[model samples]
Target chain A: DAGVTQSPTHLIKTRGQQVTLRCSPKSGHDTVSWYQQALGQGPQFIFQYYEEEERQRGNFPDRFSGHQFPNYSSELNVNALLLGDSALYLCASSLGKIVGGELFFGEGSRLTVL
Target chain B: AQKVTQAQTEISVVEKEDVTLDCVYETRDTTYYLFWYKQPPSGELVFLIRRNSFDEQNEISGRYSWNFQKSTSSFNFTITASQVVDSAVYFCALSMKTSYDKVIFGPGTSLSVIP
Candidate 1:
């Protein structure tokens, strides 16, 4: 089975523009998480979705939002992007044990906000 | 709040040599989980190991090993017989038992292997 997969491996957007990145979780995985990794720093969780509903969220702003499809695919939408928004958006999938489960990450979509 | 810290910003070791990467975390919660991940140049994050607050037992997997000490709040990883392919940016992550789905990552330690 395929691991977590992301779309638009790389994206270039202008300031104030909006962008949407996609992710498909690994088979048998029900939870999808989004993270933003700035250069030189580790990934920071943006949010997590389970059962097609946002189960939890991180410390990100309202501009960052997401949705989980019935098929377990997820989409991360960022609006009113700023230069600081330039970072690699990583998508990770795991089981919804409510505790800890091994995660599977995608290659990530590199978002460059100019 | 939870935080994962990797003291080493970068490390270089000769092939076949052994190297250790340190991960120090800060959290008031008594029960939580610690994890280590390897992100090679290919940019895919590979799950290496995960240790809970209760399982302090040191774990060994092939050439990889982890030492988890709750008293010190540290989970250190060591690579034995390091190979060139082992070079990558390693990240230490933490998740609380109450909210295991929410994980926080460290700054990361870049490991380089020299032939």
Candidate 2:
């Protein structure tokens, strides 16, 4: 069975530009979450999508948004990117909104905002 | 509010040595979950272990072990006979039972096992 997968392994963008990263969750999984990891730091929760709707969000600003399709695939969009936006964007998937279950993660897309 | 803190920012030890990473968390919920994940240079977070709030039993997996102490609000990880391959950024995370989708991660501890 395929695990969580993310596209655009690496990309570069300038400030004020918008970028979209994609993710396909593991088979038999319906929940998708996005995280941002800056250099030398741990992954910070961005938001989570369940049943094609956003279920929970972190402390991120409105510029960071996401969407989930019927197939459980996800997309994270960052608008008006700042230089500090440069980081590794990770996608994780789980079976549901259940607690204590393992979260399968993708390799992550490295975003460089100049 | 929930938070995870890895006290050690970085640690280095000889290949044959043993190292421990300390994690302390703060959570308001009575029922929650704790987790450990390893991230190598490749940037993917590999799930290591997960423990629920009620189960405080210490777990041992091969050369790795975890000690969960509710009294201290700390979950620590130990690697025995560490090897170079064990070098990575280790993160301790917490998720509340009420909001499992939002997993809060610690700043992470960078481990380097030198040969």
Candidate 3:
């Protein structure tokens, strides 16, 4: 049983550039959620997707968006990225209708915006 | 607005010394969930435990234990006989059982266990 997997373990981009980070949820899981963890801080909720539909979102701006495919994999897209956007992007997966299930997290994709 | 607060910013203790991490939460919903996660230097959030609003039973798993108090809206975690490898940043999170699926995380407490 494979755990959650994320792509581009490390990446660098310039401000105002658009970036896309991908994630594959754990097996037997149907929900994928995205979180952002800045240095020295805990992970913050971004949004969640279930059944290929966005179920909920956090306090992030319109520049941050995500998509979930039928296979339960997810993609986090950030537009007009700011320097503050440079952080670790973590993807978590759970196996239930509610978000209270045990969340299995990926190693996270570290984005460094210049 | 839901919020989780970890009062201790950082802690250092010698190996074999016991340590406790405090977590206080704020939520209007009676039905909610509390969680603790450990983030080691390797940079991954590892789930520790989860406690629902109704369950006040303190849990003990190996050298780890959690105390959930709905009356005070607090859930504390304790590690017994800590080891050097136990050093990590601990986070507390809360999520309501309602339509809101977002889990609010705290500022995390960094624990350093020295040998």
Best by lDDT: 2
lDDT agreement with native, every candidate: 0.93, 0.95, 0.92
Residue A23 in candidate 1, Cα distance off native in Å: 0.3
lDDT of 1 by residue, B28-71 (tens): 88888899999998788999898889899999999999999888
Which pairs clash inside model 1? none
**Which stretches of candidate 1 lie above 4 Å from their native place?**
none
Model 1 chain B scores worst on lDDT over the 10 consecutive residues at B95-104
- Estimated TM-score per prediction? 0.98, 0.98, 0.97
Error of 1 at B61 (Å): 0.9
- For residues A10-83, could you state the per-residue lDDT of candidate 1 as single tens digits? 99999999999999999999999999999888998999999999988998999999999999999999999999
TM-score sort, best first: 1, 2, 3
Off by over 4 Å in 2: none
Total clashing residue pairs per candidate?
A: 0, 0, 0
**Per-residue lDDT tens digits of candidate 2, residues A46-87?**
999999999999999999999999999999999999999999
TM-score of chain B of 3: 0.97
Greater-DockQ candidate between 1 and 2: 1
lDDT of 3 by residue, A24-102 (tens): 9999999999999998888988999999998889889999999999899999999999999999999999975655777
Off by over 4 Å in 3: none
The better-scoring model by TM-score among 1 and 3 is 1
